[model samples]
Target: MPATPPDDPRPWSIFLIFLRLGLTSFGGPVAHLGYFRQEFVSRRRWLSEAAYAELIAIAQFMPGAASSKVGMAIGLSQAGYRGALAACLGFTLPSALLLMAFALGLAGQGDALASGALHGLKIVAAAIVAQAVWGMARSLCPDTPRRVLMLGAAAVALLVPGAVGQLAAILGAGLVGVVVLDTKAQTQAEALPVAISRRAGALWLVLFALLMVGLPLLAHVADSPLLSLFEVFYRTGALVFGGGHVMLPLLQAELVPDGWLSNDLFLAGYGATQAVPGPLFTFAAFLGTAIAGVLGGLLCLVAIFAPSFLLLVGVLPFWVRLRTRAHLQAALAGVNAGVVGLLLATLYQPVGTSAVGSLLDLVLVLLALVMLMAGKLPPWLVVVTGALIGWLVL
Candidate 1:
């Protein structure tokens, strides 16, 4: 048998490719992942479908932003450490810069317009989340058992409003999936290639863990509660196992009780995040700015997203090896199913209850959902329409 040729080792080309993705990839993490699959897997043929799937699996398992981690893994696999850094920096910088600019613009604005716009944005966000729940249910809840698990999780979440409940529901669903779902059909899964050095991986992990633990403490000592708020929010971003939206409850826990920002302000920032074209994590920038200032905004962006970069760098080399194990894959599948259920539950409570306050709000939400699902309009367009409806009605 002929020996298989080694994969391409060039760094510069990969850097440029990811740089483009970073600049133009929008519509939050899910949209960005779609773009990535189009550009890297389908268009460029840099990775096989199996390889891409494995990377996604690994990303979904780890804490932090899944899309960002997947992008970093792709870059690392293609061109080593520099490639990973370039990919992460390129993808994250555009949104961070834009959000920073937005914060600056909002700094001197009167409260009324900002408040109204934020209200409209929240309705749109609620609609978008509803669409997400519907789509996820269609895909993840393949059978009656899964649907029951999902509904049960949602019901539990409705009864108990907190991250702990969400976590419990996810874990419970995973246990159910593992115990009830058939695993006899499981087949061998291929491993993706790792490109980073082992030493580099260890270093990255250490750095990520240390920063997450220390940043908040440092902020506390500085006598700046805003700085501490930024640190906590950022740490949530860095440590969360899902994407930007998954970080919502974690952020709410940190902010709502502390009185750093009211529930309304936090929700407003979240709504505005949906209006933006980049990662939903940029909402942190808005919240940080609202809480502290430009410095807070900057700090929040860095703290929240920094761990994603580190995890990508740390795990990319080993993830391919790690994912091929059947037990691990099964565990991940259960976790992902749980994540879907949790997202579904979230759609009903804070998002649905807060946005659908009035008859007009309900109408706007339905219209937005129609535009998004039936009309097949882009999310940004639906957002604009929602805003117009909100302005007229509210």
Candidate 2:
């Protein structure tokens, strides 16, 4: 059903495309997923709908930044590891550059006007995620069983709270799915083939595990800033569940007490981050630059994102084969439902609460959502508008 030819898009092409995507793509991971769909599936036709959906399935099932994992999977499926790096780097570069500039004294702790604009940016984030929730619910939670599963998952997420709650909700939903959903439904005729082999995937997984465990111990004993930086960011990337704004607290806790960076500088960088496009993980660039300059920023970037890609590479070869099984498919069904619920819970708590404090804020959220769903304005344009409104009103 796709319009493109069979051959893979050139790796350089993938980089250039993602580079542009990185520069302009705003909002957080959920919105990033939506943006990815626009660029890769709808506009570029880099992947078919089913292919994109399956890739999302895998990315959600893995740990780390969901959007980053999805981007890496796209590259891995298309043109091996090089494509993977290219996509990640391209998507990450703009924010990294801006955040690093902030660290280097080129930017400021934004004034009140800037703060209001950032608040507006936050509202745009909420709107983007709301749209994501609606679309994902329609596509991924279509059936009653899955819909029920999603609601249940959301309740559990709200009740339990935190990373542990999120992981449990997803895992439990997978188990529940195995019992209820139909696994024998037909799959797409042509699933995208991954370039990684099972053995290679396993090797990468082993390396990832080794580093996760080893880096912390080394940081504690060796007294190396590099090791500490790697360990702190790596651990946060590995352990955090939702993987967007939620990372902020965990990151602040890790670096602030140690005096690696000051609280004012850290908060300033975070505010500035709202104006830039790409993953929230690029906050690492700011931290890295504050601690050790541009190279530090780049190193932190690698340390933070590496685990997600490694896990994806490690799991895919095996996941593809196993998910085809009826039981596994059923479990995946539950997991998908649970993820939807988790997103809903997130919307209410962090996304909704943080952004919509007053009547004006609520109006902005509604307007942004309508603009997005009406399909006339692109997301970036809506985001810019929201920022302007925030500056003028909030």
Candidate 3:
């Protein structure tokens, strides 16, 4: 695809298209990219391969849900801020609504059938995530230097764990990138414009910063439930990387420890998300339903994802300068390596170990890998197959 197709650039049209995509798209965040490539790039001709790849690069380095961030950025490039909002809403809504129903549906029942379904869904999630880690590792750490960085990042992240450790690993990798990759990034940064004006970007950035700083203070002083809710979810959005898969551990630690929600409910909702289409970040909506209600679900959804949207919008107008610098590109290369390692480590811990327990699980996982890597089955199809296999065997 070379450019946005000549037809409708209308925001509602963008919204409607994404809405359909959201309803149909499945697998996980990485798989969402595949769906995006098929729809927006291959079918719709909305972006060039290079532009899509750049969005992926940017999403990988940023906090919050990476898939959602890329969606918003694509919308921004095509139409503007309204486009961004439309894209996000259309993409996010299907899963959000489904998750909300899952939350409500689970209120009384916790039966054998439910347990069987949940287990099956988890197996599917494991299989999908395994493919993601494998694919990312090969592409992101193709060279020896980057391979070394990936290993180093995995070691640290495995040892340290949690949001603090994740932040440190990513930040440290960027600095290491400066030293290890290239010394010639002293080239002057270029300026580029986007759908949003520089002034608007600056303003959005200031708001992001203000919320980051002031939300905590407001939580401390007033002790308001609304402020507290926003603070917790907002902080999670601002800190974690990777996407919904990475978001899981951080959110579990934040909400479960405080008794804000229960372990049973959390795990159930998590399994439920595996069955849904669109971004797994819609997992937020399920949590919201448990804690606050329907409105809470909506509020939490907004809070947890708002940082990503803000950061993408705030930076996009100036992203040309950053993307243009060769030295910076080298640094990003290291960061990308670190990102792969993080995913690799995560795959082993929560995603891999948690799902595969016996020989049956092992066989299923291998089958999943083959189908994803070689068989060329769509992820949702693979997911359905995995679920059926899980129900039968696991």
**Candidate of highest TM-score:** 1
Q: For each candidate, what is the lDDT?
A: 0.70, 0.77, 0.75
lDDT of 3 at 309: 91
Question: Per-residue lDDT for 310-382 in model 1, tens only?
Answer: 8777776565466555555555456556666677776776777877788877887887888888988877676
In the order shown, the candidates' Cα RMSDs to the true structure are: 3.9, 5.4, 3.9
TM-score ranking, best first:
1, 3, 2
For model 3, what is the alpha-carbon lDDT of residue 34? 91
Candidate 3 ranges with C-alpha deviation above 4 Å: 1-8, 27-61, 64-67, 77-79, 111-114, 183-193, 222-229, 240-244, 256-274, 357-364, 385-394
Ranking by lDDT: 2, 3, 1
The residue pairs that clash in candidate 3, if any, are: none
Tens-digit lDDT track for model 2 on 39-152? 788877778898888888777666577888888888876778988988898889988998898677633453544466667777887886677678778977889999999999
Summing lDDT over every window of 10 consecutive residues in candidate 3, give the lowest-scoring window: 184-193
Best by lDDT: 2
Question: What overall lDDT, based on C-alpha atoms, would model 2 receive against the true structure?
Answer: 0.77
Q: State the weakest 10-residue window (summed lDDT) of model 2.
A: 106-115
